[model samples]
Target: MTSFGIWGLIPPVLTITLAFITKDVMVSLFLGIFSGALIVAGGNPLVAIINLTDMVAGSLNDGWNIRIFLFCALLGGLVGMLSKTGSAHAFGRWAADKLHTQKTSLLMTWFCGLLIFIDDYFNSLAVGTVMRPITDKNKVSRAQLAYILDSTAAPVCILVPISSWVITVMSIVKGSEGFDALGVSEFSFFIRSVPYNLYALLTIIMVLVIILSGRNFGPMAKSIAYAQETGNLYNEKYGPAPGEIDIDGDVNADKAKPLDMLFPIIVLIVSAVILFPVTTYLSSIDGETITSVGAAAASMSLGDAFNNTDASMALFYAVIFTLVITYIYYTVRKLFTIKEASGAITDGIKSMVPALIILTMAWTIGTVIKNSPADGGLGLAAYLSDAVVGGGFPIALVPVIAFALSALISFSTGTSWGTFAIMIPIVMPIAVGLAQAKGLADAGLLNAAMISVSAVLGGSVFGDHASPISDTTILSSTGAGCPHLEHVATQMPYAITTAVCALVGFFVGGIFLNVLAAWIVTLACFAAAMVFLPKILNN
Candidate 1:
């Protein structure tokens, strides 16, 4: 209701408008940031300039933000090197030989998506890049590719125990007095409750079912028909012709050994998994039991052991490692000259310039929201939680309301982390208090589990799956090479369907039924979507 809250809506509106108007997302994003800075400075031109520099500096200094930026940069470099070495094409050819049918291709796409569950950003980019060519060869549309990536992004993250997300949610739950009142450790409660996260579990099943059934609906169905008629799943400009080799014919002719493409990705995945635990251990090397953020902080500080510890410094190291490894592997194999490898890296970075701009602008807008007057921003989330409790709603409905509010904030702000940060402290205590009030003393364990895990997961992913400003959404669009708005428009119906079903499942299945029955009902809904919807829509 405050002017600051109204101001918050301006950045996305301007960014989206400029992106469509100029067909340049980056330009639009920067302008949006500038406008936000102006508003934050209260129209003081001099203060606006100063705040802009400070915002950028603060973002760069933020430990989590720095690591994420570096991760994206390293991923970009790895993708470039793979493309330069023709490894992607090599893998595509190999996959083509092994899988003969559309169903196989689709299933493979889903499996790969499932396996790369470490991070949503990583999953969206890696899966889309690796699978796009194969899907196109099998006549699948870019919209379909976007759908798979979008569905997997949030759903996969929710299920993973050791992900950055799990850590964030755990911290929030543990800090809340409400959770302590429920008489269980937040982490223990969350682990036990994972089985009951019906929405996330069902969404994963729904994705696999969609892949197996080969039935598309909404914009996705139209896209599939278009691809069938035209034989171009993505835009004609982006992909190779049906029978022709890629632009680099000689490179395509040379069959890359499987290790060339698979080895690095496997290394990246295994390294992350192994290093996470090791990093956690090392973080406590300072005599402090390392929490998740603490571990990230420790990892940032262990520059020499890991080869770079400073956030800014580690980024440079990662870049150098990627370039050197790429050069050595491709140059020795004679996949490309030194010049071609260099050019490919340059092109890859150039391709991501727009994304970087968008990220920076998004970061700035986040800054404005963080620093804005309490009355002017979404501080209303806290007030709203109080209002809900005052309205005599059952304690069980706390999680449901939190989930819905989180979804709304995520949708409007276009970031899950921000929404999570704002809601967790406010909602968790209310849940615990309500559970006690309901005289569910024995059921405290179950109630805590539901409130902490179910609510957080639901809230975190609601916007991520559907929000146009969401990083996952953008990455999915970029990966599929689908127009951003097109992907949003096509996928909205599916996201809404799942969300609606999830609401009913959470209320009736999660609250009323036993835990096992809740899961069954959730899975049943997924199955119905897979089997019934396509037939109904196609007819």
Candidate 2:
């Protein structure tokens, strides 16, 4: 109910503007955070400076956020070791023999993204680390690679049932009063809603279409053309990208083997998959003590454990375990000496410095914008939520409305999780109420509810794909070793196209309360996009 009026809009708007203009994410994020701090400090410059530092520190204080920070840095170290040991190069060589063409190489990257659906952060960084070398070898532009990474990362996570994103959505839904009143369990609702998640589904479809058809438009087309013609993965004008490191000049390059890289990554993936439920089960045990891992496994259902899993913590532990084993593995193989391995890891951590700084600033600015007014933050989500609810649209349009509003909030704030937290509770009840008021049957009402929830899920992903400040977007660029803004610029067109298709789907579904009708119209829209968009935009 409390807000800073229009003041909430300034920070994100300014940050986004400055990022595009200056192509400096750190400075843009800092000024955005400082401006918000200044507002929070009531226009006092000195207090604003102090508030900025405190806010940045405060954002880092959360256990989950800090774990994610460590996971990224540790993952970078793992990547560095992989490169230094010539693992990435050797694997790329192995892949190049089979992949042969750009299309096959990119398709493999897209498939890899789909396979790693546990967490978006893990998906982006892990897929990028392994696939970047292959993509580069095949003349795929870093922008195209980033786009594939971004599109698949969040979209696939949201679509899969056993992912961190789904668990979070389930938790939110379980806590909502509407789901309780409807006598629906969160798991059931989420599963039912998945089919209606037009945006995420359409976005994934769009990625395949682009990859298969080799159609490029907008900045992505330009970047691809430039890469194919000049043999440079990125624009020279953009210079070095965040998380970019040279893996070609390592001393041990001649001795690297394909398994050297593949083995460590396989360890990371298997470790994360195992740890997610194990940690959650361990955390669930209370009062009585569970003695062994086998005993813990016997105690709870895998579904329940995953429902309550801490994805960040799971990834944090996975990366740590991988780093330890990898260091020993590389050294034992005589690829690098102990000191050499240490130095490579240090450089790898250093490579992630830009991503880390940008991530920290992104969190700080999100805090400034989403924190309540009483907490010295702008309450942007509250303001926008209030505006949408107060607009007084017809009930049948709830799906379309929810989609648009969720996109706006997520894009402006650059945090889809924050958007979900704000929108779900508000939108769910209204949807149920509207369905009831229309004298709809139980099946029809459930259909409406599913469509509405799916819209929110889809629209939030649109922002995650397109927003410059989005953590997934940032990580995608970092992992792909592409300039952040160039990734943003190239990805926006594809994101917008998918969004347009989703909007049509939501509109049709809302009017008819039919999921099948929604899918048909959505596909039709996409078909039109595929046939005509390149012709229109490529010019």
The candidate that achieves the highest TM-score relative to the unseen native structure: 2
Q: Which stretch of 10 consecutive residues in model 1 shows the poorest summed lDDT?
A: 307-316
> For every model shown, what is its TM-score relative to the native structure?
0.62, 0.66
lDDT of 1 at 170: 51
What does candidate 1's lDDT look like per residue over 473-526, in tens digits?
Answer: 988887777777778877887887777667656665436525665556656776
Query: Measured by TM-score, how close is model 2 to the native structure?
Result: 0.66
lDDT of each candidate versus the true structure: 0.61, 0.77
Error of 2 at 191 (Å): 10
RMSD of each: 8.1, 6.9
lDDT (10s digit) by residue, model 2, range 1-539: 48797887788677657755664556766887898899888999999999888988986897766876777677767766766776655665676678868899899888878876755765687678778888887788999999999999999989865554665566555544356556555655776788899999888888998899988888899999999899989986866787654453456566888788668867887887898788877666664677666677788888766655776677688889988988888888889988888887887788777666766665676667656878878877556545544665566689999899889767866666655654665567667767766677578878878898888888888887788888899999999999988898899988998898899999999999999999999999989988888899888
Q: Give me the runs in candidate 2 sitting further than 4 Å from their true place.
A: 16-23, 99-204, 207-246, 289-299, 393-499, 506-519, 530-539
**Residue 340 displacement (Å), model 2:** 3.0
